[model samples]
Target: MTSTTERPEVEPARGGTHASGEPADDLLARHRAVAPSWTSLYYEEPLELVSGSGNRVTDSRGRTYLDFFGGILTNMVGYDLPALREAVTKQISRGVVHTSTLYLLRSQVELAEKIARLSKIPDAKVFLTSSGTEANEAALLLAMTYRRSNQVLALRNSYHGRSFATVGITGNRSWSASSFSPLQTTYLQGGYRFRSSFRGMDDDAYVDACVADLRELLAVATAGDVACLIAEPVQGVGGFAVPPDRLLGAYKEVLDETGTLFISDEVQTGWGRTGETFFGIEASGVVPDMLTFAKGLAGGYAIGGVVARGDVMDCLDANGISTFGGNPVATVAANAVLDHVLDHDLQHNAARLGALLKDGLGAAAQRLDLVAEVRGKGLMIGLELVGADGYAPHPAAAAAVLEQARAGGLLIGKGGLHGNVIRIAPPLTLTEDEAREGLGVLLTALEAVDAAQG
Candidate 1:
C-alpha cells in the first residue's frame, strides 16, 4: 500500500468526466489514518462515491457505475431520491429535532404502525433501533426474557451482526469479533447445502434432515429450554443462500412445541429484495414470532427495529430507550419510503426485473464450470465460484470478477462462508434498461474470470 503522502499513478475512468481530478486516494488514506484497522472497504483501489441518482453512483474520480449491490442492500429505492430527500429535509427543518425515544414522537409512531402492518407478525408491536445489530439485540432481549432461557438456535454459515451478543450467535466465524456470548447459542443445519451434510438430497429430504437434526441437537445439546431460533430467510452475508421452501415452517413446528420463539433477521433480505414477497420469511410459509429489520427499511437512513406481539415485546419489566432509534427524521423518512414502495408498486418492479436478472445469471452458470451454484430469489442472488474441479470454493475468481465488474461500469458485492459468492441486489426502482445493462456487464465479467480461472 502507498504511504499517505505518496500519490500513486492513476488511470482515467471510462465514460466519465473530470477523470483527472485531484487524487481520489487521499480520502481513503485519511480514513486509514483515523479509522479502526478492522474497518474494511471494497475493491483493490477503494472507491469514494461522491454522489448518486436512481440506480447509479459516481465516484470522486468522476467514474460512474450501475449500483447493483445498493450499498449492501441499504439504498432501497436508490440514491438521491426526491421524495425521500424532501421528507427527511422537512423533518429536519421542524424545530429542535429531538430524537431520543424517551419522548413520544409522532413520526416514530407512524412508522411503527406501517412496519407492524407489513411485518406479518401477529399482533405486532414495534421497537426501533439505530441498526440491524441493535434491532437483533432488542429481539434477543425480548425472546430470552419472555421464555426465561438464554439458549438460542441459529443456522450454520449465518451472520447476525458484529455486536457482542450477535457475534456470539453468528455461525460465520469470518465475521465474529469474539467467541464469548452471554446467550447459549447452537448452530443448526440449513439450506446452504454446498458445505452441508445433506448436500445431495432433494429439497423435501433436505428439509426433513435439517429439522430432524435440529430436534436432536436441542435434545442432546441443551436442557430443552431454548429462548429462540433466529434465522435469515435468505442468508444475506452468507452469500444469499436461500433455504429450501418450507424449511423454516418445519422448524417452527418443533419450536412451537418447545415454546421457543422464532426471529427472522431481515436486515439484507427485507423490503422486496427477495422479490417473491415483501419480507423474505413470507415465502417460507412460517410467520415468525419476531422480525428484525434494517438496511433498506428507510431508504438510506440509519434505522432498524424489531416487531413482535404485545405480550412478548412487553415481557421486559423495565423501561428502555435508544438515543437515536426511531428518531423523527429517520422515522419520517421510513414512512415516506413505505408510501413510495406501496404507491408505485415497486415490489412488482423488483419481481419483474429481479426475475430477468436471475434468469440471465442462471444461464451464465449453465456453461461456466467455475459457477458451482446459482441460488437465491429475485434481486437477491448469489453465484458460488469454484475451482477447476468445480467443487472447491474459488475466492480468487470471485475477487477477479468483482474488479472486472467495477471496470465494466458495474458495482456488485461478494460474500459467502468462503467469500466465493457474488451477491447481486439492485435498487427496487431499477429500470429494465438498467437491469439489462448491469446483467451484460456482469456476464462479461464472469466470462473473463471463467476463461482465466476455469
Candidate 2:
C-alpha cells in the first residue's frame, strides 16, 4: 500500500505553467470558463485523476489514493478489469462502434435480453439510452403515456437525474435547478427517516405514517389520475438514505388502486450494489412498473435504459431513437460487465464487504461526535456529519474530513441536501483489507477534523 507521506508535495501551478508542462490549474481555468457554473467539484484543490487500476487512482500530481467513490459508483467491477478490457478491445477491432438504434446490433439484443431476465418485471422489455437522465426521461414518458396523466409522485430528498423533466421530480433543492417542467410532481415524505416528521417513531410506525401521508397527499394534491411514483430504493445523491423495507410496498398498494405506475430509479442501487438482491427494490417486495438503470451496468461505459412490462414499454406511438444508445461498443461492454459480475458473484461479495465496511464506519462514528449517522446497504454507505449540537448538519466538517481523507490516500465522495454526508461507495470487488485500510484512513481524518474544531 502506498502512503501519502511518501508522495511529493508538488505545488499547484499558476496560470498555464507547470514543472511537467501540464498545468492542472490551466485545465481547471479552461473548464471553468466553458462549463456551467453549477458544476460542483470536490476538494480545496480539486484533483485531476490521470489513471486507475483496480480500486486505486493516481492524480495528475502523481499522488495515489484508494478510490472508495468508484467514479461516483460507476466503476462497479473496479477499474481496468482484464475481462472488460478484452471485451472492449475485441469490439474495437470489429471497427463498428456506433450503429444507432436503426440497425439491429447483436450485442444490443443480447444485453437487452440479459437485462430483461434480471429485471424481475414480468414480460420485460427495454429501451436503451445514453445516461440515467435519459433512462428516467424515457420511463417518465412511458408512465405519462400509459396512465395518460402528467401528475407524478416522488420521495422527499430524492434525486432522479439532471434532465429538465427529471429535475422537476427531484425533491432536493440543491440538485433541482428549476421548477419548470411539464410533469406535475408532488413530493412525499418517507424516503428519508433521519430528518423525517416520523423520526422518533419505530420502523413499523414510520412505514405506516409514510403510507398514510402518501394516501392523504394523493387525495389532496392530485386529481385521482396520477401517472407514476418514481423513486430510488436507496436514495443515492440524497446521501444514501434507505427508507423502511415496507415503505415502497405500501406506496405500491396505494398506486395500484389509482392505476398509477411505480418507476424504480435503480441508477445507483442496481446491479447488486445494495447486496442480498440484484435490485434494491427487491427489498421492498415490489416489482415496479418500470425500472431505470445506469452508472455501473457498463463498467464505466455510457449506457442507460428502462426495463418495463411489454405493454407499458410499447405505450409510445411515436418513433424514437437514441443516437448512441445500445451502440455496439457500450452494449458489448455492458454484457461483459454483467457476465463478470455474475460469474464471480460480486453481489455476494458486496454483501459481505458491505457488512464489514458498515461495522467499521459505525465504530468510527461512535468515537467521533461529528458523525451523526452511518447508514446504507452493501457497498453504498454514507456517514453524515453533524455540528456541535449533534443533530444540525456540519458541511464544513464534512468538507474538512473529505480533504483530510484525500491527503491520507483515500478518495471518497460527499452528498446530501446540506452537503454534510460522506459517501463511501467502493467497487463491489473491494476486499476486506482495502475496507479496513479505508476505514482507518477515514477514522484518522474524522479525528483530525474533530481536533481542529476543538
Question: What are the lDDT scores of the predictions, listed in order?
Answer: 0.89, 0.90
Query: How well is each residue in 58-99 modelled by candidate 2, as lDDT tens digits?
Result: 877778899999889999988899999999999999898898
Q: List ranges where model 1 is wrong by over 4 Å.
A: 1-25
Tell me how candidate 2 scores on lDDT: 0.90
For model 1, give the RMSD to the true fold.
5.1
By TM-score, the best candidate is 2
lDDT of candidate 1 over 1-454, digit per residue (tens): 8657767655433443444564333566677877999988889898888889888999877888999999899998999888999998887787756659878899899888888998877788999998999999999999999999999999999998988999989989789878889989999987588888789888899998898998899889987779999999989899989888799999999999978999999998888777779998899888889999999878988999999988999899998888999888888889998899889988888889988988998888999988989988878889999998889999989999999999999999999988899999998899999999999999999999899874
Candidate 2 TM-score versus the reference: 0.95
